[model samples]
Target: MTKEENEKRLAYLKSIVARLPEKPGSYQFYDDEHTIIYVGKAKSLKSRVSSYFHTEVDRFKTKVLVSKIHDISYTVVNTEEDALLLENSLIKKYNPRYNVLLKDGKTYPSICITNEPFPRIFKTRTINKKWGTYYGPYSHAASMYAVLDLINKLYKPRTCRQPMTKEGVKAGKYQTCLEYHIKNCLGPCVARQSFEDYQKNIAQAREILKGNTRQILRDMRAEMEQLAEELRFEEAEEVKRKYLLIDSFVSKSEVVSHTIDNVDVFSITNDEKVAYVNYIHVSNGSINQSFTFEYKKRLNETEQELLQLGIIEMRERFNSHSKEIVVPFEPDMELENVVFTVPQRGDKKTLLDLSLMNGKQYKFDRLKQAEKLNPEQKQVRLMKELQEKLGLPKLPYQIECFDNSNISGTDAVAACVVFKSMKPSKKDYKKYNIKTVVGPDDYASMKEVVHRRYSRLLEEEQPLPDLIIADGGKGQMGVIREVIQDELNLDIPIAGLAKNDRHRTNELLYGFPPMSVQLKTDSELFHVLTQIQDEVHRFAITFHREKRSKRALESELDSIKGIGPKTRDGLLNALKSVKKISEANLDTLTDLIGAAKAQIVYDYFHPENTTGES
Candidate 1:
């Protein structure tokens, strides 16, 4: 904080930066804790590194960055453009706080038709030539599912797992699945459809993706007219519906421009250490969709060079179908059939310029996001507040909470929710049935649940949670402590959430004297704990309800004699529910339960059972 301290830090940074080569390269800055604070690439390492030392630059953000710099490092590269590429890659790797980050890590869905002997189409998250032709990384799984549903409805490709074969068809080895009766599949496995015809359908699908929908529609319209003329009204109607769907899709792609048949547009913007690259796919002149990729490392290359590198990398990883690449920045790649143009004038130039503006807007949006505390930070803050409120040794960033739920001492189930860095880890959430507990005693249930969760965690040698919360008051906490200390021999801080009369989250009880500490409603830390508590409670109750339902159903059947486990299972499978079985006629009962058992069931549920007969 003093001048001397500042000077020492600057000197340390200078020493590190001085060792960096003058060539194009990527650089990283570390904080006092040796944590990566920023990442970047430079066209000229010397010029870019030196700029940080200039105090008179009048940039508020840059000044803030310089003040935080404790050390610097760089990796020299062959070209400015390559430096840009490296910067993007490293930024993604480190994900420094100051960088523009693409927070959503959701994988897109792609339609993949297998390259096997059967060549069936399926939805997948990954694509490779070994599988088959992959259509897209569609933004949503539902879209891929919709396409799958439509394909099944129209093409009737086999939904069954059986292998397709001419011999199987000749021998009638396979029965047509329900999909064929429902008119959703072509029953290829039975060889009802020809391979050549199936290939034609595949070709048509490819043509649709290629923006040749007009031709397909035209062909379908002609076919439909011909069918109608031949008095095949139902078949003609189906073809008409297909044509309408295609037309609707084409109309929705209104942004398609005749001039720009196939191209990808890219743009880039930067703060001192962070950079954002925004990409738009302009196929046939329509801006169908756009995405943003962020880089945390500083770039030594100019904005233009970085944009070019991003285009190449993006195309390599995705967009194999794209023919031309368009950008406002000058690209350095010599990709065949790829045109890198910086439009100086005209409508095409205007569109490119607009894309760059859009990139800047995206950069600004990221800046706003960086200003807000991220999920990890929010978790940490929540843990700190929870620690302070609960009066603990350290922030309970890794807290595990438990809850048990049941109906009338039956179908008792427990749940454990783990919070890492104050955030609920939905993936780590676990559910358990109270295998040993026979009654409504919550304390025993809590003991069983905590024991099972921690027993496995210890056996696996996993990291222990900083805090453990039980749903009940002192009784539950005591059960947890006995199991943890005496049984598990672990010394984890534990607490209990005692609810008020309104069934709302209330006082916190930990070590004796039970502290009642309230958390700020606006704090991120409070929200995190509340989320974990809610999640654990929800999970426990859900399991309990399901178990209760199953037990109730089982009990109903257990009351009937001559109905052992297998017979009971068969009755349930056939009738699906107790209500259905209760209302069944002798004929239906005979069909499912057999003649001998049917008479017994009828007598059991009839007047004789009213007096306590089995």
Candidate 2:
């Protein structure tokens, strides 16, 4: 924690760097405890790793980073770019706290066409070469749905099960659905459209996916003009309408900056331990989109790894469009077939500088805010207030609140919510089901829930909550304390919300004589506790309701054979709801839920089993 200590660590790291080979490779940094703090890649391991110790760098941030270095390790690669790619791969896999990570761990929709005689387009999240063509990682589900809607409207691609045959199109012996009737589908199954015509439409949809919007519009305009010349005024009007739709879609994209067209700007901010990378995407001389990535760690290798990941992830996430990405630092990242630039001087350079400035300002603002509160002050103030009011020992920085909810004891669930420094730590929220207790035994249920909650923490060697709050009076407080002492073997402070006859926040309840402490409604401490209690109650109740609904649906389906967890999940996801599955006929169910499971469903719904029996 001191400069002298840091210098000793840096000296050791410098010795390792001096011994490293001067070839392309990756490097890793470790703390005094030998924990890998950060990972990075460089064209030359020796040079890049040694640069961190350079005394000429006057930046405090750089100095601080260097001060944290305890040890260095490296692996030589074939090339600098190869090293970059390897570093990114390592960062993603390990998620080293210091590396700037790209991808918010959210899946975006991609359009996939199954490679069949008659390819069918579907909205999906996973894309592979096995699937014909994938268009996007569209920003959201709504945008993907909109694109699908537009594609259906403009192209009317087939959405049918009838297989394309050598003799002719095999028309399924069924009436065309509303999709076909509404002109959203070409009705190829009913033989209303020729295979050649459907294929041509598919080609056009693919072109749109390729982002040739201007060319597509131009082609549409020419067709409209041609139709008008041929006296087909109605056809010309349809073309104009389609053009307008495309125009509207394009216009919704936000413009970021006017000076640069088709460029992406990258910036990063770090607070010793955590780093955030922000990307500003510009298209057609306007900023269209922006994104940020948060990473943990304080190592040079980790920083470089983040830089590499930022580029690859942005490219993959924005692969639908053609654009160049600009980064302030030259990342030795290898992106096959993708162009990246670090402009030295020009309009692009100015944009890059602006982005760097933004990153620095963001770091400064965050640091200023962090310095104002100081975690100790925030924690001490909240805890001291709680202790004084509740009359317990020490400040309770780690507080846990519990709540239970159910409908007539059905799907009864209890939730334990944790707060640190007066801020909700959602990551620590734990839920439990009232399995042993039968109906509305709130006291018994509270004891069972608290025992289950803390027992796990004790087993895991995790930190225990400083104070525990229950959503009831003396009974709840007693149950909470009994569980902590008997089950957890720890003496933790316990209290309960003493609600009035109207079931409103009235007073706080504590042990033995059941002393009640009144709280002023306007007090910050009171408001904070109330907020935490309410949130836990709401969360527990919502979870209970969902569990109840799922349980009801699962119970109904348990009778069906060939329906294990995997198949049931597929059925539930494909059919969406139980009502839909129950109503679907054999063939419709088979197509979606698979043949084996479909038969089981048919047998369950219709005991006669005429539809599914061989």
Top of the candidates by lDDT: 2
Model 1 misplacement above 4 A? 1-9, 67-71, 105-156, 160-175, 195-200, 203-207, 210-252, 266-279, 284-317, 320-614
Candidate 1 structure, TM-score to reference = 0.44
TM-score of each: 0.44, 0.46
Clash totals, every prediction? 22, 11
**RMSD for each model, in Å, please?**
18.2, 21.5
lDDT of each: 0.72, 0.73
Model 2 residue 74 CA deviation in Å: 6.8
What is the C-alpha local distance difference test score of candidate 2? 0.73
Writing each residue's lDDT as its tens digit, candidate 1 over 361-449 gives 77766555654746454445456667777778877767788888877787778888887775567898888878898889888888887
Worst 10 residues of 2 by lDDT: 292-301
Give residue 157's error in model 1 in angstroms: 3.9
Best by the TM-score measure: 2
* Cα deviation of 389, candidate 2, in Å: 27
